[model samples]
Target: MNRKIVEAANIAINNLLPTKSRSLYDIAYNRFKKWCAEKNVQLYSENVFLSYFSENAKNYKSSI
Candidate 1:
């Protein structure tokens, strides 16, 4: 991935997560990337990241 994308992903992950859990953050980040890839969306911006959360938050809650 491009450095900017990686950096953006890191920032997004940090903002979304409550605590500093590296493993959990990694899992979420990877899953976010996979979802973006499958949807042909870029996962390198705040808007896209927020959109993913907005779209999937309910599902995430139900699954937990």
Candidate 2:
């Protein structure tokens, strides 16, 4: 079940991202999932995914 969910998340992330952003998106998505697991938080919903992506995008943009 967890593998399915993670795979779905990976597909969704890949499909929604632009080509130029793929690498960064992959890194951010992995980090977001890891953070969720470590913090005991659920990250399967659309809102949760968007929130995580947004937060990571902010950080990534600032670093550039």
- lDDT of model number 1: 0.83
Give Cα-based local distance difference scores for all models.
0.83, 0.79
Provide the RMSD of all predictions against the true structure, rounded to 1 decimal: 7.7, 7.5
Q: Write the per-residue lDDT of candidate 1 for residues 1-64, one digit (tens) a residue.
A: 7999999999996777577677787898799888899889953788888888998976767645
User: How well does candidate 1 score on lDDT at residue 31?
Assistant: 92
lDDT of 2 by residue, 2-33 (tens): 99999999999668978999899889778878
What is the lDDT, from 0 to 100, of the residue 22 in candidate 1? 74
> Among these predicted structures, which one has the highest lDDT?
1
What are the clashing pairs of model 2?
A: none
Runs of candidate 1 with Cα error greater than 4 angstroms are 1-20, 62-64
Q: Worst lDDT window (10 residues) for model 1? A: 55-64
Q: How many steric overlaps are in each model, in order?
A: 0, 0
